[model samples]
Target: MAKGKDVRVRVILECTSCVRNNVNKKSTGISRYITQKNRHNTSSRLELKKFCPYCHRHTIHREIKK
Candidate 1:
């Protein structure tokens, strides 16, 4: 038996607006979403437009390290 590389990996995406706003003011919480991505195809960080409850608008969410 041999070990194989993981094709799909779980990723966490956080709201960009919330992250920048948090520096100036205190926020209740930042919007976060869990999703899966193909490592071989998406070598760079994943970003998507998502709704943020805190910001109350669709913003760009970037992948963060675990």
Candidate 2:
């Protein structure tokens, strides 16, 4: 198996507003962003403020289970 330390991991950040407001009810998915983080540097779940195309605004995006 590969070493887990100091490895870059892939994660998805989803828009908070869109989820809370229930925007895009017709769609079967929520707005999400793909990004990577250093496992050693930041072990905690990553949260970022990013623009959501569906919501058309900047919102706090929290990492979701892959």
Q: All candidates: CA RMSD in angstroms? A: 2.0, 2.7
Question: Largest lDDT belongs to which candidate?
Answer: 1
* Candidate 2 colliding pairs, count: 0
* Tens digits of lDDT, candidate 2, 1-66: 665653898899988777877754743457899999988888898999998777677889999998
The alpha-carbon deviation from the true structure for residue 17 of candidate 1, after best TM-score superposition, in angstroms, is 0.6
Clash number for each model: 0, 0
Per-model TM-score versus the true fold: 0.88, 0.78
The per-model lDDT (C-alpha) reads 0.92, 0.82
Which regions of candidate 1 deviate over 4 angstroms? 1-4
Which residue runs does candidate 2 get wrong by more than 4 Å? 1-6, 23-29
- Model 1, residue pairs in steric clash: none
Candidate 1: lDDT of 32?
99
- For model 1, residues 1-66, the per-residue Cα lDDT tens digits are 433588889999999989989998867788999999999999999999999999988999999999
